[model samples]
Target: MTLLVIGGSGFLGREVARQAGRSVTTHFRAGGPGRRLDVRDRAAVLRLVEELRPDVVVNTAYVQADWVTTAEGAMHVAAAAAATGARLVHVSTDLVFSGRDVTYDETSVPDPVTPYGAAKAAAETAIKGLVADAVVARTSLILGDGDSGHEKFVHALAAGTASGGLYTDTVRCPVHVTDLAAALLELAGSTYAGIAHVAGADALSRHELGMLIARRDGLDEAALPTARQGSGPLDVRLDGTRTQARLRTRLRGAREFLAR
Candidate 1:
């Protein structure tokens, strides 16, 4: 399949590419080439898509720094996807929801809390308006190598424990980058159009997850503080029943992901 992976160099994007490459070889078909194009630039995005003429365009580009960046970024990407008539699989976040105590499904209305959540929710709106054959995959706290976004959580535990303690109240359901990437590829190929959830199997608090990581890595989990708290939403677990039904590869939990 001819595919265009935006933000192809990022943690999840790279894994999607890797899986695509391997899938192609295993299936005895050639995977399409990759291009590192920023989704925020309208002209550049349109030009790249027009030139590549890919059958599927997967957007993994987004910024957490500000709402403007994400809103603009996703706008151009959706536009490019519409212009090219390509199936667009846009990666969204679970934060788009209000982070209410209850677990969210695809049907749940998004009531974003933080600026990041609001930005992603806005982007979803733009994508839906622009493309008819678009699928928005809403994932949560992606965990892979510490080099990825997981570094923030990893470091937080290390630093918090070194100083005094860590927050046990905040909770999240973090999925493996590879698993999320696989689901993205499936979404790109399928006719499933709309927002879908993709997250880890179990819900875990920050401290519990940290302890698991510490124990697995032979770190001092006991030294970590039993009480740590942060601002914003907690317990933003997603119900990925739809994703689980569609994806071929088995979705893994944080423990299985860390073990890998």
Candidate 2:
């Protein structure tokens, strides 16, 4: 199947493109290993989609601090994908939920407390309105390899280069990048539409996860500073039971993957 991966140079996007193999066309913003396609440019996105006419378009392009790129750019991509009848799989994050709930499912109403989360929530809403057959796969902290910024931060913290302490109260289901990519690829060919929670099986606190990473990487866990998250709801653990039941690919937790 012909596949188009947006933001292919990104951490999760790169993994998706790699796993997708030869039939995939990758698009990146600025400079990367793929054709330059800015998602922010609606006309450019439309032109590219019309020209390629890929069977599926997987959008993993988003800048956490940039609302225009994260929210409006996603809408542009979704619009083009809809116009070309391409199946769209948009990657989202668990930050969309306000940590008040214990666990979130596909049915959970997004009450984002942070700006990044709000932007993602807006993108999801726009995508659903634009593409009827789109799959909005929301995940948690992505961990795998040493490429992701999160992983880099963890490493820096372990090495004493980063000053901030890991939060013990903040909780998340950190999914491996490879597992998430595989699941997204599987969903790209399926008829499943709307929101789906695709995350790890275990819910862990930031400090707990840090300790696990430290133990796995042979770092001193005691050296890693730990603190409780501030008053704002920090628990953003996702309920991946729906995703687990839908796909044959198993989503392992941080502890499970690190043990390997």
Q: lDDT (CA) for every model shown?
A: 0.75, 0.90
Model 1 residue 242 CA deviation in Å = 2.4
In order of appearance, the predictions have TM-scores of 0.87, 0.97
| Candidate 1 local lDDT, 122-162, one digit each (tens) | 99989888996689888887777666644455566566634
On the 0 to 100 scale, the lDDT of residue 88 in model 1 is 87
Candidate 2 stretches greater than 4 Å from native: none
Task: List, residue by residue over 1-260, the lDDT tens digit for candidate 2.
Answer: 99999999888888999999999999999788789988889999999999999999999999999999999999999999999999999999899899888788989999998899999999999998999889999998898866666667778998889989899889999999999999999999888988888999999998888888777778877888888878665888899787789998899988898772
Q: Which sections of candidate 1 miss by over 4 Å? A: 22-36, 151-166
Q: What TM-score does model 1 achieve against the real structure? A: 0.87
